[model samples]
Target: MEFLARATGVVGGAVARLRRIGTPARQAIGANPQIPQARPQGIMTLKMPVAQGWTDGRLPICAPGLRVAAFAADLDHPRWIEVLPNGDVLVAESKERPAPPRTLMDRAAQATMRRVKAIGDSANRVTLLRDADGDGVAEIRTVFVQDQNQPFGMALIGDRFFLGNTDGIVAFRYEAGATSLAGQGQGLIGFKPHGHWTRSLIASPDGARLYAGVGSLTNIADQGMEAEEGRAAIWELDIATGKARIFASGLRNAVGMAWEPVRGTLWTVVNERDGLGDETPPDYLTQVRDGGFYGWPYSYWGKVVDDRVAQDPALVARAITPDYALGGHTASLGLCWMPAGTLPGFGDGMVIGQHGSWNRARLSGYKLIFVPFADGAPSGPPRDILTGFLSDDERIAYGRPVGVAIGPDRRSLLMADDVGDVIWRVSGA
Candidate 1:
């Protein structure tokens, strides 16, 4: 078995290298990306960097005039972050739940996941980080909530706290400065577990509703549409009545969501479907409309049909084009609004954490980026905020940024580096 695994890795690595020989740098980026026609391949491209953690206090390189430091360290796979009213930061520490391998592709994917340190038993907990002295580093670290089913998103509304577990939203009674949750939580909304399992939650501006992102159970609904009935869409849950309804549909993997303050519109960064060519159907950042559809299986990029899926003409016609493309296979996930003046030389914009990609021969999105906003829309090309997560040869990853949030100070930025097991803080130098 060991010899076979080694042989598979050698073959896969060689194939990946050969595919990268003439691959051009990514072109599908910015507000008007040149999206190429899809070229489906019988064998999907698979390339992932081996995970090697940071050493000797080395940190990610920040953009000029900005500096980064470890705000909190030594946590288990922290995937998402939330800041409380009292300046406490909450980190949701969890990982993907490994599924049993049933096919050759599945077995290969599992092996790749293990090689990249991407698959493991979830820690199933949320930890609190407190910066009591107003320094960038967190002085207090404690487990706030435990035994969760892969909790990823958290929201505090009034005295009630809500968590987005893999299976549902759970509510708990919260105190302003409490270190840990005291009682059992009540499940508010139930959802199908696993298969793009990170449930990202954000509170409505009015605080009467909560929006949760539930990803599809299978890529392109290959498991059939019935299995995807309530997946691949954001659900709006009424806090008072616990009634939930689908807010928007056809978002393949809308992981990060925030409100664009200028226009009062909700925005999200979505991870597009795979199996198409490296540059096909670029992942996007868009203003999410209340009942709008943005094609998933039927079409992509506003009615551009994907012949792989069973067609639905009516649905395709209604598909909305995303506002901006963040490059293909970038895995743009974490998103947070940064008001003007939060970071030096950076005006009001959205910050995205691209967790990097594995489905492409040449890598894309292994860094933190910022997209400037004007009149509540993306105004310019993305700017690299932090980089150097990958090694010079691109064979090893030092870290992968996941969830981003504004620090409680409202000046610094906090990012969850799942692979590095650290919460990084970025501030003006």
Candidate 2:
């Protein structure tokens, strides 16, 4: 079996490379990314970069006029970040719980994960970092909350702190300057876990409700729609009443949610369905409507039907088009609104942490990006905030950026590098 698995992976990689030689060049990105014809391969592309962490004073290269340094290091898979009112930084240290392999494809996936250093027992904790002297680096590091089930998104509403665990949303009592959460927490709502298990949470401006992003169970409902029930959509949970409803449906995997500062509209960065070739459907950033639907299994990018899945013509008709495309298979995740002047030379925009691609012949995203916004939407092309996460040959990744947020000082940008186990701080040069 070991010999067979090795042979299969070698053959699959060779086949994927051969197919990519004839694939069309990718089209424009950002505001109007071109969607190409689907050419699903018999063997999916699997070119993952090996996770080789940073060493010997190595650092990610930032865009001109910007500088970056490690704010905090030696973390355990730091994936999400939240800034507290008292200027304390909360880092969610967790990863996906490994599922046992059941098939050849499953076995191959597990192997790939190991190479990329993705398979591991999750830390299941959130740590607090404090830079008491207002310096760029953190001097204090301590576990803030622990023994949770893959906690990701976090938001503090008044005296209650809500955490989006893989299975549901849990709320704990919070004190203004406390470092650790005292109780086990109360489960507010439950969600079907595992498949795309990162539940991202964001509170409404008025703090009346919390919106959680729940992803689809399979790539394109391959496990049947029954398993995808109450998923592939963002749910609105009323804080006082504890009632939740589908805010919007057919989102596939909406990971990051933030309000447009100018227009006060809710926006999200979604990870579209995969296995439709590399560039068939682009991941996007768009204004999320209260009761809108973006195509997932049935369609993509506004009624561009994905013939691989069962179709629904009525639902396809109402599928709303996204505002901007990040690129195909970019796995665009972390998103936060950047107010004007937060970083020098950049105006108000959205900062994205593209975790990079695993199932594409050519890599797409492994850096931090800033999309300029005007009025209320994306106005200009994306600017590279930080790069050089990948090596010269693109075979080794020193880091993969995830959650992005402004630092407590309101002048620095903080990003989580899960592969490197470092929280990087970016500031003006």
Candidate 3:
């Protein structure tokens, strides 16, 4: 099986290169993308080669009549963003922390991942950016929280601030207009070590509850289902108490989530499992329902079984289909729902940051887009809001956008570009 998988990947890579030529640059997008049939898991899947491709004095190209500028530069691998009520932007400058290799395969996989821009030392800190003069660029930059473990998500409610670390969730006492945190944070819960280390977090609208997204330990539960306990799901934690419970299950990796303003529904962008050809089950953006099972290793796209894992008839019976597909291997991670009139021509819709792909031969994503919404659901096809993250050669990437949030001005969009180490602000021309 291993030999067959390797041979298949070699042939597939050749086909992928051919398809890359003359094909529309942004073809792998839309509501229901064309998904390839599931194939046998590959032994050594195609790993994209990363290059330091950013040039000095260069900026990304934006949509017509839109402008993109570096709001804050020289950031340390910023991955997430949040705007405080006081109009300050909090950026989570984080990177993945790989675990000690347990086997030769583990070591090999880690090394390959490094070539594709996955491995990095966690900054373990959050920084605050203030544009006191109402300018697009931040004039005041300070470390908001420091000395932590792979922190990714952050939330603030009154005097309390919550942060989601790779291993656990913690809270700290926050003071209005404060620049930095000097005291210890109280731990709420710890997660399983290793695999899909990013833990995204958000607070409820009323501040009564908090939600944290924890990804699966391995693709397709290769480490055994027992290892998946308390993983691959979203947890709803009561802010008053340190208690949390599974809010939704069967999500492979719900990286980014938000609450719809009209219906108050929770939506997320999930990164699905890989090794199944260039496209099989597309990653999706869906409205998450309580106790919903959106299929993981057992099935995909609602009851379409993945033969890779042991099939449980009963589990597959309850799998729910996602609301919208963001294309296979797009790695759509950053999600933010904007209300009507947040920006001109962009009505109520969700802005998603497609973090690009390393598993496929021809890359997809690498841009920020908006999915128009109406009647509390995704209504129209995705429209490009920001482009030009990758060079025309397609072999080198200038930046990979990871997070998107409405700026304090409520008229501009803020995005975190991890590769370029800059926070960009976008506004209408």
Best-to-worst order by TM-score is 1, 2, 3
TM-score of structure candidate 1: 0.97
- Lowest summed lDDT over 10 consecutive residues: which window, candidate 3? 20-29
Off by over 4 Å in 3: 1-33, 102-105
The C-alpha RMSD in Å for every predicted model, in order, reads 1.3, 1.5, 3.7
lDDT, residue 377, model 1 = 92
Residue 115, candidate 3: alpha-carbon lDDT: 54
lDDT of 1 by residue, 84-198 (tens): 9999999999999865766787777777787677878889999999999998999999999999899999999999999999999999999899999975599898999878999
Encode model 2's per-residue lDDT on 1-429: one tens digit a residue: 445445555776776678678565864377777788888766677777778889988999988889999999999999999999999999999988755666677678767776677766899999999999998999998889999999999999999999999999999999998989987799999998887889999999999999999999778998888889999999999999999999999999999999997899999999987777777688899999999999887999989998888888999999999999988888889999999898999999999999998667777899999999999999988999999999976788999999999999999899999999999999999
Total clashing pairs for each candidate: 0, 0, 0
Question: Candidate 2, which segments miss by more than 4 Å at Cα?
Answer: 1-9
Better of 2 and 3 by lDDT: 2
Q: What lDDT score goes with residue 354 in model 3? A: 91
Candidate 3: lDDT of 72? 94
lDDT of each: 0.90, 0.89, 0.83
Using Cα atoms with residue i matched to residue i, what is each candidate's TM-score against the true structure?
A: 0.97, 0.97, 0.92
lDDT of 3 at 326: 87
Task: Report the candidate with higher lDDT, 1 versus 3.
Answer: 1
- Residue pairs in candidate 2 whose N, alpha carbon or C atoms collide under 3 angstroms: none
